[model samples]
Target: MKQPLKVAIVHDYLNQMGGAERVVGVLHRMFPEAPIYTTIADRRKLLPELQGADIRTTWMQSIPGILRRFKHFFWLYPFGVRSMDLRGYDLVISSSSAYAKGITVKGDTRHICYCHTPMRFAWDFATYMEGNEASPVLKAAARLLIKPLRWWDRATSARVHQLVANSTIVQERIQQHYGRSAPVIYPPVNVSRFEVSKEPPGDYLLVVSRLVSYKRIDLAVEACTRMGKRLIVIGDGPDRDRLKRLAGPTVQFLGRLPDGEVVRYMQHCEAFLFPGLEDFGITPLEINACGRPVVAYRGGGALDTVIPQVNGLFFSEQTVESLEHALRSLTHYAWDSAQIRKHAEQFSEEVFIRNLASLIEGQLSSRNPAARPAVPALAHKKKGAVL
Candidate 1:
């Protein structure tokens, strides 16, 4: 019998229950015995399914208030991630939006990175700094380090044996930023959990997201308020209070709720409002799975998932006026709920797992002399040293 490859899963952090965490959860389920490596984990915020996994944290885990303040210690990440000893694992799979992909492995070991995007702050510093709440002095300090961080990001990215991007835009980003090619693999949506509501949809539009500056939830609040449309916002983040202040009486903030409650909200909402550029917006796909249409920003990952006049309508610009235009247009069109749900079925969790498994197996098979057909050493050398 062939021995199973020992696998190790690495993620940037485990402090939030978001799309990235859901990817980690699926990866863990696929490799049940594989250990998970992260910078730090907050059990209170992590999914219950992930609590039983063998999660190992690095030295940064001991830093003061690191769980709640990991972003504050960005300078330490390169050192902290490299400190991990992954020499024993035959296959290392990193689910990264940041430093997890930087983990080093022995030449004999294979490393596959499911990249969300090259570190957003390093590649898009100007945009990331916008609407940031950091002190001016701290922001200035960050500005000084951008050069070093960019250099480190590019250098570390080359360490991976293979790269799998979460969307086509991310694939292009990997090529542009790292000078490497990657296959596009969309993020999984748990279509089974969300059911289409039997009743007529509610009068209110909905926005569900981490209330971060870059997410641009403020646009939704502004558009809905200005149009005098009833809107419901469900999420919690640093931007929550500010968003609440900007919201009009027609808008309601529900904060964070249980997944079941969120699903019900998705089912009943008139249309899901997605007014931000995303790497691959899974929420819009999830809303579609619940038989609802989405009003999304036109750029980035939304371009891949939200088919215009099908599952969702796209706003060409990110401004309040542009979103307001889309919302008004949304009212004029009739959406086919069954067809929207069918489009979402293409990106189910099972499809994600199957594609990822096939990709990883292909990497392993290409490495095994007994499994792969023989090629001349010169030919192999010409193909370039396999990572």
Candidate 2:
């Protein structure tokens, strides 16, 4: 009998977990036996599926309230990532928004990286300088670190045998940040979870995110308040109170909802409003998969997922004024719910699993040309059985 595949997966910090962590969870589904490794894991607030998984982490997890001291971890992450025990796995799959791609791998093992974005602060420091969030001293330090980290980020690209990006936007980023080419495989959307239905329209629009300073939920609140539009902000973070103060009486806070409740709101909402520059906005895809159109900030993954009239409209700039214009213009056009769902179907979980299975098979087959893989026509089972 053939031996089962042995895979080791690595990621960056698993603290304050969000979409990228969910992507790792999806990978777990494909390789159920694979043990997960990362820099940090906060089990208290993590998804239930991740509870008992064999998640190995760096010594950073030993630090008390590591997330509160998160800024310090960045200084130690480089060394922490290099220290992982990756000596025995047949395959290494890294789901990275940061330095996990730089993990040390043996020459005999194959590697695949699903890059979320190439360590944004390290590679896109110039663009990030536009934000006034960081102090000048810290910005200067980040700028200084940029060149060296960029070199390391690029050096690691050659370590991976295959690269898959979440969107064309990230495909471009892969080229610009790492000088590497990667195929676009849109992240999986659980299309079946959302019920695409018409309902009594609420007075407010929604902005769902982690409420980080970079996410710029502040801009969304400011724009909606200034425009006299009602807004419903979901998800909580350090910026919640700050964002709430900026919003008007028309704004409501839903905090974080279960995956099911969020979808119910998505199905019944007037339209989903996604206002951040995400590596790939899986939430917007989830919203669209629910037959709701999105009003997205023009940059990032929105460029690939949203078509102006087909499913959603885009704001040219990531500013308050621009999003206001897009929000106002969105109501002028009508979007077909069925077409929106169809566009979303193209990025469903089934597609991701299929593509991943193909990529892994291709990698293993290339390693062993003498022994052919099972026929694709057999549907992963023995042939000559009734359909």
Best by TM-score: 1
| Residue 140 lDDT, candidate 1, scale 0-100 | 82
Candidate 2 to truth, TM? 0.87
Cα error, residue 221 of model 1, in Å, equals: 2.0
Q: What does candidate 2's lDDT look like per residue over 64-165, in tens digits? A: 867655654455777888889899777889988778888988855788898888876677765444434557787667667777777777887878888888
Compose the digit string of candidate 1's lDDT tens values, residues 1-387: 445568899999999888899999989877778899998888888887798999999998889888766677888988888999998777899999989999999956889999999997798876666645678899889878888988999998888899999999999999999999999999988888787888889999999988888889999999999999999999888898899899999999998898889999999999999888888988898999999999998889998998988998988888999998888888787888899999998998878877787687678766855533332221223221211
Q: Which whole-number lDDT from 0 to 100 does residue 55 have in model 2?
A: 93
Candidate 2 local accuracy as lDDT?
Answer: 0.77
